[model samples]
Target: MSKVTEVVAELVSPIVTDAGLELVDIEYVKEGRDWFLRVYIDKENGIDIEECGLISEKLSEKLDEIDPIPHNYFLEVSSPGAERPLKKDKDFERAIGKNVFIKTYEPIEGEKGFEGTLIEFNGEMIKVEVKIKTRKKIIEIPFEKVANARLAVTF
Candidate 1:
């Protein structure tokens, strides 16, 4: 996360929580000529357009007051979608029993990526059940080694 994202996350956390939503992630990035501040949010069943619009309105007002970002950016508030990235302990816990894709900072067990069923998360480690041809294997991944993790949709 960039400094701008960190600061924006701090500013939006309370607002998101108060609205009975979970703050999934925040991204501050430049795409082509435009800078975008994207805020991902979620709830139990799902999120709708109205919820997103409300969040955008509230966040826009707050951002206007604070004027944190020096550059003009588009503020987007929306759902994380099916392949939502898991960035927090709670996210990992919720992802148990679900299919996930995990990328490590370096190679783990001769591989840098794993896509499998997320069997467990113990705050320090994760156990994924991966299928190799006709055989099934369980891979233990240290939490610290995970560079990226997200829910995976298998077709």
Candidate 2:
């Protein structure tokens, strides 16, 4: 995470949690001449447009007061949607038995990416059943080595 994102997360986490929402992720990126600060949020019962608007209003006020980002940026707060990234230990736990796509920081079994059913999550590691050709193989991945993970939609 960038310094600005870390700071923004720290400032926004409390506000989100107090409003019964979970902080999914934060990103500060440059696109053309504009800078964007995107905040992803979620809740157990999901979120509505009004909830997102409320968060955006409150968080925007806080960010403006802090002025942490040196560059001017547009702030966006919203739900992560159907294919939300699995970022926390609890996320992985909840994802067990569900299809997922995962990318590793380094190659494991000569592969850096895997998409399969998440069979298990034992806090420190996850086991995924991946298919190679017609055969299926189970691979163990450490939580720390996961660069990214998210729900996969299979049709």
Candidate 3:
């Protein structure tokens, strides 16, 4: 995460928690000629439009007060959606038994990415049941090796 994103996360976290939501992620990036600040929030049953609106309003006011960023940018607050990222320890723990897509920094079992059923996550490693043709294989991935992981919506 960048310094801007870190500051934004620190500023936005309390607002999200006070609003009874979890702070999923914070992103500050430029697209074309425009800069965008995206704040992702979530809840147990999922977040609603109204909830997002309220958070945007609150966060906007707070940002205006703090004046953290020098450049003018668009602020967006919303849910992470169906394929929410597995970022924190809680996220990984909650994702047990769900289908997930994981990208590793280095190859594991001759592969760098894995898409399978995440049957278990025991802090240090995750056990994924992957289907190879007609057979099922279980692979253990060390948590430290995972560069990115998210819930995968498979049809």
TM-score of each: 0.96, 0.92, 0.96
Q: Give the C-alpha miss distance for residue 100 in model 2, angstroms.
A: 0.5
Highest lDDT against the true fold, candidate: 1
TM-score of 2: 0.92
Where model 2 places Cα greater than 4 Å from the true spot, the runs are none
Which ranges of candidate 1 are over 4 A from the true structure? none
lDDT of 3 by residue, 13-130 (tens): 8989998999998889999999999999999999899999999998889889988899989999888988999999999999999999999999999999999999999889989999
The sequence of per-residue lDDT tens digits that candidate 1 reaches over residues 1-155 is 78888888888898899999989999988999999999999999999999999888888888999899888889999999999999999999999999999999999889999999999999999999999999999999999999999999999
Worst lDDT run of 10 residues, candidate 1, spans: 1-10
In candidate 2, what are the lDDT values of residues 15-111, reduced to their tens digit? 8999999999898999999999999999988999898898898888888899998877889888988888998889998888999999999999999
Query: Each candidate: what lDDT?
Result: 0.94, 0.92, 0.92
**Distance from true location, Cα of 1 in model 2, Å:** 2.3
- Give the winner by TM-score: 1 or 3: 1
Measured by TM-score, the strongest candidate is 1
What's model 1's lDDT at 140?
Answer: 97
RMSD of 3: 1.0
